[model samples]
Target: MGPRNMAQGSSQKPEFFVNPEFITTKTRAIADRKRENTPVPRFTALVPRGHTVPVLNKNTLVESPDGSYRDGPSTHGTDRFERRRADIVAAAIPVLNDQGFKGMRLTAVAELIGLRATGVTYYFPRKEELAVACIESGFAVLDGLVAEAEREPDAGARITQLIALFTARDAAVRQGEAVPLASFSAIRSLEGEHRDRAVEGYKAMFRRVRALLESPELAAMDQTDRTIRAIILLEQLFWAASWLCDFDIEDYPRLAARMADIVLNGVAPGAIADPIPSLTAPARPLASRDESKESFLKAATRQINEHGYRGASVDRISASLNLTKGAFYHHNEAKDDLVAACFRRSFTIMRETQIEARALAAPEACRLAATVEALIRFQLGPEGPLLRTSVLSSMPVEHKTEILGHSYRISRQFASMVVDAITDGSARAVDPMVAGAMVHAAINIAADARPLAMAQAPDIVARFVRPIFAGFLAA
Candidate 1:
């Protein structure tokens, strides 16, 4: 997106609008292009064309002079290759973090760095090939941090570094879908070698943490259990970065401290400190007590978002706000009505934003980009968590249908963007409806990513989103 930057040109690309009602077709076409091969996006950004050849990447192994890698060598790269790989990643991660890998194309990567797509292919031939390059680059960076820990003899410092990496991502979760939007697709539908590597990577991560946490005093603790616990906390952080997008550790200081305490001090019921005392207070109706309806709804919304509608009892919501049932019911007919209100509020905002993006842009790409960009911002931004909560999880059939209808309208509105991209034959593999659905899938992934996890990366978001649109954007 940076460097020479063709993708983020001042000029617009294209646009289409989907209906907010029923899905008219089981399959829809967005764009169709001739099966002619085009130059792939090379890692070279903003430099003029040259007679360069594609070299060492995913399938090819980079070997050192001595045959074996350095003292703490990672699986990929020699010293020269490592530097080049880092350069490629440095130039490209923003694609994932900003547009999402799905949305980002190697062409855009080349344009950002001022080269032709063929030049990009010179670095790595296939899209998946570059994808692997990008992934290896990310891991290499982590490897450096781990290597630093190895340099330190003290166990505490090593453990701290491991924990630090858990919370650290490419950037602070700035945009709502910023962090998780890109990676979510892979996480959701892991397959092939990438899937296997991902699983192994996580396991390796835990093993490192366990290794660091070991000490004479901690000898009695089970490293396997400790690693498991760390993974759970890491998952929570992923939620925070992906959903909340920007909360610092302090917002939930206790969460981090509690985890550390648990990890350091065993949870042998005897060894653990007593949890904060639970209230023994009896529930009362809102009418019998005094509390504002605004307060009641606010409390309910938070509960529903966090604990879920089914898991969050009406009594709990009312009790949380210190209100009685009658007072709570004074403003609404039933919980269904309240949920409907929530859904309506969210749907209206989504609908208006789409219409606004369309209104602000022009015919072809700009119009489409405006709409897609707006959707991207919303899915990753403040509306992210609320969007997830708006879906009627564990609700009754009628309620679930109503909430889904609300979601459908929002989704249908997005279909129009795909239509615009397809009309121009702007991107590769551009099927307007399929692209639209893929966008939905991308958003769903973002919704599931927690803040602390790797998903809270703006670069990763760009990688995913941009590639997706790259597939949709007409040449």
Candidate 2:
């Protein structure tokens, strides 16, 4: 369910992992360019040898849609089709890594087999279906790694084995051989049964890690903190794919060993983590303080976006606006109320965005595209901080449920637009629910800005919607 999934591969693939110096240089280049308001420079990561790259070649001996060998006579299309399906999913893993779920194009997969987009759909029917298959496969691979790691007799050895699993995946990413699940955010793009299944898949993975952490050895730690520690370790492992690009691929084993040591024993033996610092608001002009609620909400939104809900202190929110804690109490009963209020304000803006999209006097397809574009622009703009929905998971269950209801309503509206487009022949026949979820997902992708590079807002939005409307292979 993570936006990206892994492929089943041995942990012995040798490749030159991206060195830290390369990443630092790229980061500095991007920062300097952003400071000058210049477009960010884009570069392609090297794809690992043997990982198929999509290229159109008619002479290539590729499997046909019905599982026939296009170059010669073959068996009936039953088992071959399933194998082909697996191949398509494998091909897509790299695309998902490069472009994400929203930015991924089915055509890329088709090109891997020298087929058209329609040919790919003959099997998947809908893009979401393909995504599910890839995600399931990826998670299954991860599950296997966890199961393997569990077999190790020593707890530290077990942890090292698990770290090695991810380290291998990280190298694959550097060489573009696989996708890292850490960057996977497309889980929120699923709806109804798909969403339920995906969420459960995520929970299962989390539970596996939690179980590993809860192994009798760490019994002295608080259960809640143990869970947090498990989450933190997993997060660090997930993101290691990104950071590992800067280190020699050969160092992965050493890196995994060191990581295992750090996780099992603090960097400083017997040391405890320090408290997270709070965000303080900068000096605001007198005009801003008059609307205390608005000012506080803005400050809180920024803080929460950066540090998460639990980290965003109510005390800090009040201080950011140069107001006392009493000023916060006067405007809101508690931090929960403030968070709820923030969710309301964020979703309201989102709903208004859809409303504005619908109000436009244009074809349904155009309207849908416009609405998505508007939402993306809004998410990346100053209001972007408010759109961080990660905080909702930390909210009281009732509050989370209420806010989710509002979120789903908006998603359904997007789905409705997709249904309209398909009905009018502006889009191919796709599951409206999945299409809607994808649109929602794409907006979030824009917020993340992973695949967007230096494109203008309009261009970025257009590219984001292209695969959704025109199929990935559309010319």
> Superposing all C-alpha atoms, what RMSD in Å does each candidate have to the true structure?
22.3, 22.8
Per residue, candidate 1 scores C-alpha lDDT tens digits across 1-475 of: 0001112112331111111110111211111312222333432221112211111121122323422111133455465454333334434555544443334578766665455788767766665545444444333333333443443445544444333433332122221111111232222123466545544544454455445545554465454333433443333333334322234433333333332332232112110122211111111122233345435545665555544454456676778867778766776678766766655555555565556555543443444444444544444554243344323434557767777776656655556665664465533323343334334444443433344344455643443334233321111
Whole-model Cα lDDT per candidate? 0.40, 0.52
Worst 10 residues of 2 by lDDT: 270-279
> Residue 221 error for model 1, in Å?
1.6
Tens-digit lDDT string for candidate 2 (294-373): 76677887666544565567776887788888888888888878888777777766676666666656556676666655
What's the TM for model 2? 0.45
Candidate 2 clashes between residue pairs 3 or more apart in a chain or in different chains: 2-184, 3-184, 3-185, 4-184, 18-245, 19-246, 20-246, 48-175, 281-320
Model 2 residue 415 CA deviation in Å: 45
Instruction: After superposing candidate 2 on the true structure, give the runs of residues whose Cα lies further than 4 Å from its correct spot.
Output: 1-77, 172-183, 269-475
